[model samples]
Target: MATEALAVRQAVPGDFAGWLPLWHGYNEFYGRAGDSAPPASLTEATWERFFDGMEPMEALVAELEGRLVGLAHIIFHRNTGLVGPTCYLQDLFAAPEIRGRGIGRALIEGVYARARAAGARRVYWHTHESNAVAQRLYDGVAERSGFIVYRQDL
Candidate 1:
């Protein structure tokens, strides 16, 4: 699928300047509302890892006129008991003003393409239940699995 106006591609180190805003916007949408600091060193390491072909983690970005408006982060992990490899879409965020303009769709489609290339049978992600707008988009692209995920901070 060709994204004409929205260019979707793997993120590079130099893209961090563009990514930072979109990333924060995404986190804010999740109700982590206030500014949260991500160490510069860790952010640099993430950008480096995405370009490191040896790593299973990957990231994609959507650019319009050389400005980033959206991004997607994907992680490949093996599932237990023959569940096979799964691609988890860790994050998907688009600038609020740019929402519904295909940037988000392009980001998702790019993740699907990457996951397919990696031999993944399925791709999955989660969103806050109250995020109806996002859920609408997600519903159009993929089915919501029946299981609910739980976690506890160790």
Candidate 2:
């Protein structure tokens, strides 16, 4: 599908139904499905945060023919290394059936636009190293920071 035909915009409450499946798909891709899936409460809170004025999180969606096919979740936070807030693209996903149709790219560009509008100094996200297909797309739009990520469960 042509990128122009995709409408990337802020997600609204009415989008919940369509957005849920894509959100599940994203988690499943990261090995977070089945028994490991995130708690329903967590997902509910995440969705609510998007529309909460006090929250710094936002969600963008890509629609084609009135159906949501992609989603990008972003968070803006203060970074000690920078004077302005930095945007972290927390999650991004495109439906499996439309993986190569530029929906993901459009959603990413939408995040970039939101970051810029919010005065964020930078925008970044991480993907599993095994996701070479996504890496190919990431390579064309942004540079790798060469910084490995580490996490420890509390």
Candidate 3:
């Protein structure tokens, strides 16, 4: 931040080189260590979509000295009884070494800005029940809905 080093820009195919590690790190933090990531094919497809200009998925990367240090993936989804599509923050991550250095905050703030620009009625995301580190930051930036998420594979 000495020189305002972080720049959040729309991700492109070429950014895959910088984003893959952060993406994997994000997944790992969610407790998926092995065979837990979206298939490589899906990752490839996602990279392509980020630059397609027509896809609803949007991603931004935070770069410093031309190196990607953080990322945020966002999407708009329909919600019944909502006045407009809700903006969901699908993922947010920063390099472990750079965490608490405000990079993660920057990525999330960027997501908020994108959502507002897209005319979204609201923006939100969920973290694991025990993710204390993320919760600390989430508590500061947004209100907790007190909802417990349930998931079933297959």
Q: Give the winner by lDDT.
A: 2
Better of 1 and 2 by lDDT: 2
Q: Write the per-residue lDDT of candidate 2 for residues 30-140, one digit (tens) a residue.
A: 999999999999999999999999999999999998899999999999999999999999999999998898988888889999999999979999998999999999999
| Overall lDDT per candidate, in order of appearance | 0.83, 0.94, 0.84
Name every residue pair that clashes in candidate 1: none
Give the lowest summed-lDDT range of ten residues in model 1.
31-40
lDDT of 1 by residue, 15-54 (tens): 8889988877776777654456555676678778788888
State candidate 1's TM-score.
0.86
Error of 2 at 48 (Å): 0.5
Model 3 C-alpha lDDT per residue in residues 1-154, reported as the tens digit of each score = 4428778877877788899998889878886658777788887897787777777888999998889999999888888968778899988989887788888778888888888888887888988777898999999888898887888999
Single out the weakest 10-residue window by summed lDDT for candidate 3.
1-10
**Cα deviation in Å at residue 49, candidate 1?**
3.0
The best-first sequence of candidates by lDDT reads 2, 3, 1
Candidate 2 vs candidate 3, lDDT winner: 2
Decide which is better by lDDT, 1 or 3. 3
> For model 2, what is the C-alpha lDDT against the true structure?
0.94
